[model samples]
Target: MAADVDWDPYYGDRRTVLALVGLNLDAAAITARLTGCLLTDDELADGFAAWPGWADPFAGFFPLTDDINPA
Candidate 1:
């Protein structure tokens, strides 16, 4: 995702805010590195509460099992 942003300058503007769900993502670190900032925990929950689609931003790309995979 960071590479995509670096390759395409407009990518940042296209996806201004990123909402990570069902994953232990470091939003602050990501925010500092990429131009597209991630949404906070409260904001993510609010989005899920407001919209059903917001609950799964990855469109079911996440793993089915509860296995830890280091990135």
Candidate 2:
């Protein structure tokens, strides 16, 4: 059997959340990676607005499905 604990406390630390998602980068590197996408202000707004409906909001700006494994 599995146990259930309140997740509210863990949500307060972004690093913990990102680590849970498999992204080990710190906040600054994450910010740089995201900002380096070069999305325009309007595009950024559109991405946010389309988020709930779109399965992947960043599909327009990034490749979410491409295999990145090196040979």
Q: List where candidate 2 sits over 4 angstroms from the true fold.
A: 1-24, 41-71
lDDT of 2 by residue, 19-70 (tens): 3145554677666765565557676669666646645434564456668773
The whole-model C-alpha lDDT of candidate 2 against the native structure comes to 0.53
Clash pairs of candidate 1?
none
TM-score of 2: 0.23
lDDT of 1 by residue, 1-71 (tens): 57565465643544345566756687775557554335666766686556553545454545677668656
**Which candidate has the top score in lDDT?**
1
Number of clashes found in candidate 2: 0
Q: If scored against the real structure, what TM-score would every candidate get?
A: 0.24, 0.23
Question: What is the clash count for each candidate, in the order shown?
Answer: 0, 0
- What TM-score number comes out for model 1? 0.24
Question: Which whole-number lDDT from 0 to 100 does residue 41 have in model 1?
Answer: 64
